[model samples]
Target chain A: MIIPAKSRLWSTVAVFAVAVGLTACQTTGGDAYRAPINAAKTQTADDPDKDSGAPTDVSGDSVARDDGDSGITGSIDDYRIEDLSPGERPDISSDEASVWMIADRAERRAANAGNAIKDPALNAYVSDMVCKIAGDYCDDIRVYIVRVPDFNATMSPNGMMSVYSGLLLRARNEAQLATVLSHEIGHYLRRHSYQRMKDTIDKTNGLAFFQVFTAALGVPVVGSIATIATVGSLASFGRDSEREADGYGVLLMARAGFSPHEAPKIWENLDAELGDTPRSRSFFYASHPAISERQTMLRALADEVPIAGGGPGRIGTEEYREALSPHWESLLADEVSKRDYERTERLFDALIADGFRAGAVYYQKGEMYRQRGDEGDEDLALAAYHAATQFIDAPPEVFRARGQIFQRRGLNVEARESYAEYIRRNPEATDRKMIEFVIGGLGS
Target chain B: MKKLVRIAALASVLALAAACQGYTLVKGGSPVEVGNAMKVSPERSWSKLTSGKYEIWTVDGPILQQILFASGVEDGEKLFPTDAQTPKTLPEFKKGMTELEITELYRDTLVQLGGTQFEIQEIAPKTIAGKQGFRFEFTFATKEGLQKNGIAEAVLAEDKLYFVAYTGAKLHYYPKNLPDAEQVMGSVEIL
Candidate 1:
């Protein structure tokens, strides 16, 4: 059942009370957030495969020892490809059972809320690709293509994968997309969420103990804020888990016959688009390893992996473009609406460099320049719009943009003609009445 | 004195509850001043809320439906608060902006307010407060996945902006309160 917000708050308070009660008897000081290593790591360590040479302790200590503060070291060469056979599910502990229940409830709520994109063809395409990487364990996974414009894909412990449209827009080819999907699948395979949840509970309990003590000392507000901060810190993956997932993902993509080189390229392109922004401080970035670190490790792993027939393997650029072509306008529109003109401009430049859809790229570039409206931006916007119209597949909004610019410049005759052309091209446009009104004013 | 104390206790409780819910009742048939430059006449009771420059009125709740007003917003001011460190990148209103530019400003405001997916359904010139202005219809979804439909009208005069907007959930709330919102919009006048 969906818990009401107030009830959920009270339940959390109850948990806090229990924790406080437990802490009242103890006097030892310890860091609360550090929980046990992931169950997969623990299990693998206990039952080390004699053939694989995988590390026994896949923990942060190992990463710290290898990489130090440079965030570069700890190669995935030690990780081995697990034999995931058909009809095999991980044995769940009681803790994992509880997490599974929570994940199930969340997945049900998300589906019921109409957030899951219901396009059968698109769903099949993405799921088929995921299954290719998943191998015999494919049936255990369910993919949801959500219409969010953030570069993220999440894997829930209950085998629910949400692929956001922003990832699709950023991914230049199928191999890059596969790389992300495989990484998320790696999280599921490693059972990171279950491990993370247990760690969060331990942290919360500790924070609650501290909170109660602080409240007793007459600083309830500060204590409450501390509790929130402790919880918020749990959202990002731990460094070791991220490293493990990255290594596993590279192996999985190579096994699926996708070019493993695309993995590093994705991060390289992302770093270029990000351009030294202090995103590493953000919670979203904090959860994962540094981009440069991941890129370096992925490149190393890709170089080590042997090609099936010594070929470049499948990039599937044309296939990926074709699958997403029908949704390009709406996706590009979402990207532009973000109003991050610099980032959007960089993205458009990359797309143009790829030479896939020049007309769409120019149209979006026009939008970015038009919306920014800096000194000399209007002329730049006009040139981009004109360039867009030179292609056969230029969006109908080009005429509207041209008309608005012309009208602003007091070129009434040109504005009228442009508006008329826009109206003629898009007869069923939602703003038909509005454009008509502009045309009438130009006549006067 | 005892009775008065009891009454005061009840009043405090009610106030706390109202604050927790994020709205206060604006009695029906009341004339509410919106911003510094405009007044609106409401035919029915509504919830009134304030966040930065936007004065919001709602029937069900702010999450379901809202009517927002902003008057005399100065140039160089943002429609919403932005991260102080990244001020240059955030969209801000400028003086002598054309109608299209103003519309873009509003679009950016909605985006900054966490509208993940946004589309302008319609835009055109309209009369607001007896002056030439612009009106637009739009649809968007919040980051939290709330689908909303909205309409807005704005006029630039006296080197300041006067604006009103209504937004509601696309499924039920928008259609239910759109007519009432339109009527409230019609009743706006520059004072």
Candidate 2:
């Protein structure tokens, strides 16, 4: 059950009280936000938008220490991507095990959802391009083309690379995709995941980090134990990992012959896409350098590489748009469900403006209206839904919405027919049960 | 000159080998096996399974590779929560289900976990425990080196219906583990 916002905060306080009560004997760290030690806090806790009075500086310079600092020396060689096959690389026994587990779990969940694209051509294109640019540095890495509409990429500790579909959509060319992928590759090579995990353990557990890893249960088990058994609070690693990845990613992009400046440009788009969303994704905050910070870094790094004469860099723009064309309506539907009406409406208008006529746009407009309800213009919604149904290939959602409209207007038979058509078309839909129940309520 | 060239090649090989020496990768050993088959059917009055206790199974082969418990089991109910009012959000349980909704449920989970692209193999009808159901094969890649591949069996039986999901790697490792999973499925019985 979802807690009301006020109660949620107080519930969190209660949870905090229980946690403190449970761990009262343990020594509290200086200037530390006492970690909640309860199952409720662990599983259901949301990532807070602002820091809880914790001191953090997200600048790139924080991780780059002087030469005498443990011999790291900020040398170029330290960040080079080591060429190691999957079997050759050392086990990530020291990394944040929870993050890897979550990533793995997410992958499994994706596979289970049947949300994968079966296009071998697209997969091969991405894989080939990524390897050509970054393969020499690492060999055991795996690439996945996820069907998400957001422009993002993530590199997991286990060398699992997930590229969002939106990235494919937004990139000006193959070079742009390579620039982002190369940047992520840099994160893996620089051992950011491992370091972050270690840093988390160090900060939270103090001297107990060594004990946790060396337990008789084994490291993976220890990691899982930490996540499952202990309070799974939001564990953001110290700033070192993000800066390291950013620095290394920029270098990789530059070496691979893409404009390093594109990295920051990507972030600028990302920030705009986010608009006024209160909290940014944890991965972006956790792993990626800030957009402004990254933009500045990339501009400075641009000095090392030649600013080449321009070419028509609209790499795969047409193909990207074409491939996504079939799923445009569905993607819009998904965005609408997430209550991202602005993005949904914008995309709808873009498709219409791009000559995608027929009832798809009209129907989507109607769907957006219904979603808005009291917060939206209902008259426009009714007009759009009616206009949408006039098309030859109207989707089940349109019929369903029309059915709801009919039901509201006291047209029982018409509503039943519409609902029936919707149910028939979307037999595999998640809402089938509810629709069936609704149809049942309409009576024979 | 030939002898000198051979020495240089050997030196380079040794250097490469040394660079790899830092990683003690745990690899092939005796193949792991599922010793006993246990079927978990929701029909035989589930007083034990959903008793708020996580059931963990211990097996051997790979380190830390243990069979975990599938929590919150019930007949004709979803393992995870979805909006009940939204019929389109959940699929139809026709006949009642051609394929278990595990794939469907798992995909939803992925989106929550920041999955941008998720997909699955085609689903078809099948039978388990002498009742009609469906089988779905699926694969996914993520930022971590975890290539999770899975198959789920949604079966029906007298007074009970449920699904069994077996997941492992998409590589050579999956084949090695499938038999163990099968053995476990075979072992499971209403308890």
Candidate 3:
């Protein structure tokens, strides 16, 4: 299948189109040099390749007439970037509906984090400020703030931007957060997700059918998308979508007046955080080129536009830590879930060093120990639980572990006391009845 | 034509089943006698689960089949604990069980491998290995965007509670393995 370039016309035509616009960027010795900032401004001006300049070579012309209340149209600035309408206007309100769906999902996930950690005040604070920074350039897209410790974010098909709490924690300053947020906002303004969804809808019918069939037929589809989307996102918006998202994100970050340089730095930090796993490891950052290449391009761009304003100095590292202190343990729970032992261990050590107070950390540490019941590490396992109990506000799990160990050693009274304490502390814990029974059995 | 093809497929499976009748042990060796009963142990030798990397005790039985045993003379973590909740929950493999602890025990035995999203669905009582048991199902959202369910049943038998947990991609899992799981459950006997 012929892959359409951003101009949406076949590459043969795009090559010619680029040859014609060759005056925009000066090529010296076969290497492209950063054009003056005005060149970008000039190239994006009233060029015929204006809004939605993707190729008109769209073969299947099934038009889903958008609910036509002239949906968020490109403002004068939007006209500067190529108009990114994938095909005919989809229902305008349909976009809103989707944004609400994703935002609702984010809210539900936030609810899952214990109330102590999930703070709407914090979510509102970040959302309000971050949107103000990026929205100055893109549309006022709705942002969903989730309470997770992983530094990740995704812009769905609609204008729903999900900002993981981990991203806030990891970012050193407001400019860094702005760089990341702008990249995601760029996804929406550039219409990457919708274009991808549309392009892949027909092609991925088989995989989608398989997934739907498996769900209907009662098969586990968990962690098996390798058989579905990974093979070829063609039916869904393939690698092209990711590359497009990255390019647009960088462009948006630059436009938003944040240091575009931080975009690549954010990626490099992510790579380091993840131990530089190769790009092909999982489809998470599917479109991200090598970290070096991204940094190279970002640096080139930064050299072109020396922002009049210097870096937005690192924002509240201490305040970010304090705001997130409550959920430090639960976020560690995510690390355990992802099986990033190296990262989980590091987070565990950091939390201990930082003197954060939370019952979840102790519980998670206890869990880590329990998971590590390797030979000769029984002592380590025991120690993890002991540390879990040292927390000022220990969860019932701490008592349960102590109780289980005591019972195993035939210390029935100690076990009974521990179990009873657990029962008293976590009256509503899922395993309450079970622990009570164990306590009763000890008495028997 | 399609109907004929399907019937032929079914007939072929039936024939294959008839061809492989009766119990078979690894290397076709004699069944190991434990207590008063003979049992098929996949732990006959080194496993391929983690051929040279790590070891996990993974036992693949017929659909619905349950394998029972301990790690060594020293008790290892419970394979399927009596109590396990979902989402914010964990596999009751036992206290102090490491990633290697569970993954290594059952090496390369699980087919149709998928992730477990431990969400507490429901907890109830059921019969497993002819003893009092707790049956808990862990619910996980699958990559295919479906919720996969795993039912783990643990029962105290032969001075030990055998834990059998079965998780499969829905369409071809529980239905196909339920009968085999039942047979394994029935065949279980203590020393």
The 10-residue segment of model 1 chain A with minimum total lDDT is A24-33
Query: B28-93 in candidate 3: lDDT tens per residue?
Result: 223333322224333232111111111112123222122333322114333322111111122334
Which CAPRI level is candidate 1?
incorrect
In model 3 chain B, the worst 10-residue window by lDDT is B46-55
lDDT by residue (B1-191, candidate 2, tens digit) is: 23323333343343333322222221222222211222442211111111122222322211112233333334434332233111223222222221223444545544443332445665655545454445566665443324556665555544233545554445564575676656555444433
lDDT of 2 by residue, A299-385 (tens): 565454443334322234455555555666655556554545665565566555544444777787786776465444556677787
**DockQ of every predicted complex:** 0.15, 0.02, 0.05
Q: Model 3 residue A220 lDDT?
A: 20
Candidate 1 Cα errors over 4 Å, as ranges: A1-77, A81-93, A112-118, A196-205, A208-235, A276-297, A303-312, B1-32, B50-53, B78-90, B96-101, B142-146
RMSD of each: 11.1, 15.5, 17.2
List, residue by residue over A1-444, the lDDT tens digit for candidate 3. 111111111111112111211111111101111111112221122221111111111222222322234222212222235554433234558633432343344334333432113367766666765555554433545566654446566554434556775666556555567666765665656665555433434444554444433322222222222112111111122334444445555555555556566666766665555554442223333334455655665565555543434554333445655655665555666555544455566556655654555456666766666555556454665677677677776666677777776776678898898888887887776656555655666753
Q: What's the lDDT for residue B99 in model 2?
A: 27
Q: After superposition, how far is residue A376 of candidate 1 from its true place, in Å?
A: 3.2
Please provide TM-scores computed only on chain A for all of the candidate models, following their numbering.
Answer: 0.74, 0.57, 0.53
The lDDT of each candidate is 0.66, 0.47, 0.43
The alpha-carbon lDDT assigned to residue A137 of candidate 2 equals: 44
Q: Would you give the TM-score of chain B in model 1?
A: 0.82
